[model samples]
Target: MKSSILTRPFYYLWTTQTTANAADVLYIMALTVLVLNRTDSLVSAALMPLMRSGAQMLSGLIAPLLMNRFKLPALLLLSQTGQCILFLCLALYLQLNDNNSSLVLVFTLVFIMSFLDGWTVPARNALVPRLVAHEQGLLKANGLISVSDQVVQFAGWGLSGLIVAFLGPGHTLLLTVILYGLAAVFTLGVKEPPDVESVRRHTAEDNSAAPSSKWHTLTEGWKMIWQMSRLRLLTFMDIIDMLGGSVWVGAFTLAFVQVALGKGEEWWGFINGAYFAGTVGGGLLVLTLARAIGNRYLAAMLIGMAGYGILTALYAINTRPIIALILVLLMGPFAELSIVNRRTLIQRSVAKETLPKVLSAQASLLNLVFCISLLVMASLAEWFGIVNLYLLAAGLTLLALGVGLIGRRTFHNAADPGAGD
Candidate 1:
């Protein structure tokens, strides 16, 4: 099974993605350190992430135009290569200037790099189905990717500080450049199957049937999601989930530790570590049971969503720090189950040519929702207290689960031909 599923193309894709993800973590850390060192203000440091998110959101909004024109491997390569060049330039600029005045230039480079990176996720996801030899491999492939992502997240944050402390931010940025370059090289080795040509032909035919315009291209994915009942529900659930998930951002988690658990930063770190640990476990579990879960994706997704919601609600009400840690740890597997299945469903639900656009539209919407959700969650925490804010998040998750329950039949029927068109 492993031999069949882990084809050469898939191996290249996985390695490319994993290397790029690690580079992302290093880049963010190095940039944050640079910003803080130059500006000496927490607010200034925070702007790095804000700008990255804003740039990525804008990029996602316009990604369909490029996706329509370029092949997935080319897009992935372009994104990585562009980021590598920009990051190298940024590092060189900081090295040459050695002054705080270069901060503006630094931010501009970061935003541009992030804009390019916005193409990576959707392109990567769209390419996965093409790279894998069999439909059954999708689950295992996604699970493997998820596991790597979680490991990166877990180790990246924990070690980035130490890496930066040891190597300094400038050197860290240089290291990221190397990673990006390697990723670009790996991307060059990824070869999509011949069926992708047929997908492109079909897309070309559809394009010829209609009068194409920038507005049509931009809104094409949105229209598809709205018209397709299955996609519509899935996207709606995603929005709700993002809104709820925002409560787990660093600031809110810190506040929760201080207010509810009466713990310090260490506990906050512990909870996060536990959550990532759980996610890794969950990914392995899914990988082991890929065939069984793959057969009943919707059912598994619903169960996962239900478990996550119930655990979230319980965690919100709990005051014990240890229990809170355990609850979040438990939430990991459910989160992974739902996330992996939903992503797999999205990849399988749409036509091959259409998947990138659909994913781009969904990514844009989720990014916007997450940005707004951060502000909303912050305000709620200030007004009603952190506990209530979490309760509200739990409520949102449950509401999303309710939507899944209501759409169970629609999701199942989505397997039919043209059901999600």
Candidate 2:
């Protein structure tokens, strides 16, 4: 079981990844609170998710070029380094500012943090299979990684709030830099496989022969989506679900705390962190009860998320801080199940070399949809009230439920799910 957890390469990858992700969770929650506290504006909070989505979009644009041009290790180093600088800048800006009028600077820092994050993820994800290259090890590695992610997210959210409460958001940002630095150190020693250069050369040969443009290569992914009906359908459903049902997160929850619930503004970090607590709880459930219960891939995701949606709607209606936190805790597991299954689906379905591109595309789609959803959800929260806005999400979740039922073909992928991760 220990070896199962530590399978050499994947274990090392997890060491770095867990630290990086923990920092991200904490940074995002803290950043959200800091921005809102300073500006007293909900729009400033949208900057958090917007910057996040922007990072994904930026990654989608540059992933292919970076993978082709530079070694993954070098790119990873540069990405982390850039993020470190951005984080340091953010920390300094916060310390120096006596006047709270520097809202734009906060937004700029969010974008920079997200941009570096985007550049980092592709190299990170693609590197995972390299560490645990065996076939059977795929599931174990994925499960272990999922577990690690939950652990990090669990700590990040829970501890960030506590830190913010005691030490201030500046200390929180400073801690984020330390975590990123640790990730960078762990990443420094990862040995690329011998075949990596040959793979690069082979790609160069193919590119030279036809001079196939990047846009052509990328849009090709879009075209292939339709050829694989199930992939296309799942992708479509993801986009729609994000835009329709998934929009009530990030700032909406903050808005709910301030506007509808009349909770004081200082607890935004705590509120967001509560949602991550739910994620950890949900993830543990997936790891434990999966075999004994509704264990199928698509079914598990649909059922889990729908259950979460109902709870979210209930939280929206209740408006009590305690009830909201309880429902958020329930939401954690469902969120993790959805994340893990979706990644599993992508890995199983897409070809090995194409995985990066496809994953980048998936990230792009999710980002685009989330951005739109944030905008709509923000406006709707203003107009309809956060409770009604959340209720609307519940209604849309029913639609996602229908789509999942219709696309039951995904459930069948476990038997032959291909080279994803």
Worst 10 residues of 2 by lDDT: 412-421
lDDT of 2 by residue, 255-279 (tens): 7788767887666666667776676
The stretch of ten residues in a row with the least summed lDDT in candidate 1 is 412-421
Off by over 4 Å in 2: 1-6, 29-40, 89-106, 136-139, 161-172, 192-197, 208-211, 244-250, 254-274, 289-295, 313-326, 410-421
Residue pairs clashing in model 1 are: none
Computed on alpha carbons, the lDDT of every model, listed in order, comes to 0.86, 0.69
Instruction: Please provide TM-scores, in order, for all candidate models, with all chains considered together.
Output: 0.94, 0.81
**What's model 1's lDDT at 74?**
87
TM-score of 2: 0.81
Screening candidate 2 with a backbone cut-off below 3 angstroms (N, C-alpha, C), the clashing residue pairs are 278-329, 278-332, 279-332, 282-333, 347-420, 348-418
Candidate 1 lDDT by residue in tens digits, 1-421: 3558668988899999999999999988888887778778977876776687788899999999888766788889999999999988877777777664478778888889989998789888988888887888988999999999999999998898899999888889889999999999999998877789667656656665775576788899999999987889899999998998888877788889999999999999999899999999889888988977756777788888889989988988899999998999999999999999888888878877788899999988888888788777767787899999888888888899899888877865745433432
